[model samples]
Target: MKEEKMRFPLSPKANPQAVITGEHYRFTVLTPKLIRLEYAENGMFEDRATQTVLNRAFPVPAFRKLENDVSLEIITEAFHLHYLKKGPFSPNALFIEVKSNFTNYKNRGRRLADLANEF
Candidate 1:
């Protein structure tokens, strides 16, 4: 049998603020932090020093700065993306899940407890 890997649709419009929605929440190999937070006096997208923060914070974001002079352009603000490889898993089965609250990830322990014996 031939092997085929699946790809998920990662859109920049989905979460303009990088809110970590739907598919992005299950990001094992990929997650979102903040790339460029600071702004210039005229509200221009300047100084990409966030790379340093990203190094320390693990996964950070990249912004789509306007294609004009930062001083003149208002830079309405947006986001960018880059493929990240986190870990190595066996290419045997393909399983994908959609979630909202990323904070509840830790409680995945009692998934199959079967506490009460229904005799």
Candidate 2:
């Protein structure tokens, strides 16, 4: 089978004042199918483990800022990503939700505990 990928390059948009201030959140829309979320301390580097978990080779998505500084959204033909900034001292304050138009009947409505119990 062939691997599917995004058709366009990723675009990143964030509040000009947003930074790694040990409380700020960074959102990068890597592709229509993938996004990278990063949090840093004291305006420094992001955690290596976090980077590892979110890293993937995919085309980037287009980004757009919301009406307010604390929120933004990214979208493609199949997926939509929304992000919200929480606070400064809370580098992990970034909240994200990804919605996809596609559906998988087999995995639908599976709870976290149910998946954990499977193993």
CA RMSD per model (angstroms): 20.1, 12.0
Q: lDDT (0-100) at residue 13 of candidate 2?
A: 38
TM-score of each candidate? Answer: 0.17, 0.40
Scored against the true structure, residue 91 in model 2 reaches a CA lDDT of 20
- Cα-based lDDT for every prediction: 0.25, 0.42
Local error of candidate 2 at 90, Å? 9.6
| 4 Cα displacement, candidate 1 (Å) | 1.3
TM-score computed on alpha carbons, candidate 1: 0.17
Per-model clash counts, in order, read: 0, 6
Q: Which tens-of-lDDT digit does each residue in 36-103 have in candidate 2?
A: 55555554544333424433333434444453455445555545444444444222323233454344
Over 4 Å off in model 1, which ranges?
A: 17-32, 36-119
Model 1: per-residue Cα lDDT over 1-119, one tens digit each: 99989854333322244322121122211233223222123323322223333222223344232222111111112322221112111111111222333575642232111311211
Candidate 2, residue 59: the lDDT equals 44
Please report the candidate that would top lDDT against the real structure: 2
